[model samples]
Target: MICDRFYFESIDSLHVKINKLIESVAIIAIKMQNDLRQTSM
Candidate 1:
């Protein structure tokens, strides 16, 4: 029972970390796109 709980918690933490990474990547992409538009203009 203890082992199962620990395994579940680890999976939960990993999922949270992945979500944060994706969010940051999306923000960076938006910033890069804005920069490209500014340069073109």
Candidate 2:
């Protein structure tokens, strides 16, 4: 039972880390789009 709980906890933390990485990637993509528009103008 203890091992199962620990395994679940690890998966939860990994999920959180993936979410953070995705957020940062989204922010970077938006910034790049804005920059592209400015340069095109």
Candidate 3:
């Protein structure tokens, strides 16, 4: 039972980390897109 609980906790932490990483990537992508647009103009 303890092992099962630990496994779930680890999975939850991993999910949170993945969400943060996705958010960071999205922000970087938006910034890059804006830079490209400015350069084109």
Which candidate gets the maximum TM-score versus the true structure? 3
- Which digits, one per residue and each the tens of the lDDT, describe model 2 over residues 1-41? 99999999999999999999999999999999999999999
Candidate 3 structure quality by residue, lDDT tens digits, 1-41? 99999999999999999999999999999999999999999
- How big is the RMSD of model 3? 0.3
- In candidate 3, stretches whose alpha carbon ends up further than 4 angstroms from where it belongs are none
Candidate 2, after superposition: displacement of residue 1 in Å?
A: 0.6
Clashes in predicted model 1: 0
The weakest ten consecutive residues by lDDT in model 1 span 1-10
Per-model TM-score, in order, reads 0.96, 0.96, 0.98
For model 2, the superposed segments whose C-alpha errors exceed 4 Å read none
Task: Single out the weakest 10-residue window by summed lDDT for candidate 3.
Answer: 1-10
Give the per-residue lDDT digits (tens) of candidate 1, residues 7-29.
Answer: 99999999999999999999999
lDDT for residue 1 in candidate 1, whole number 0-100: 100
Candidate 1 is scored at a TM of 0.96
Quantify all predictions' global Cα lDDT against the true fold.
Answer: 1.00, 1.00, 1.00
lDDT of candidate 3 at residue 29, scale 0 to 100: 100
TM-score of model number 2: 0.96
Model 2, C-alpha of 15: deviation from truth (Å): 0.5
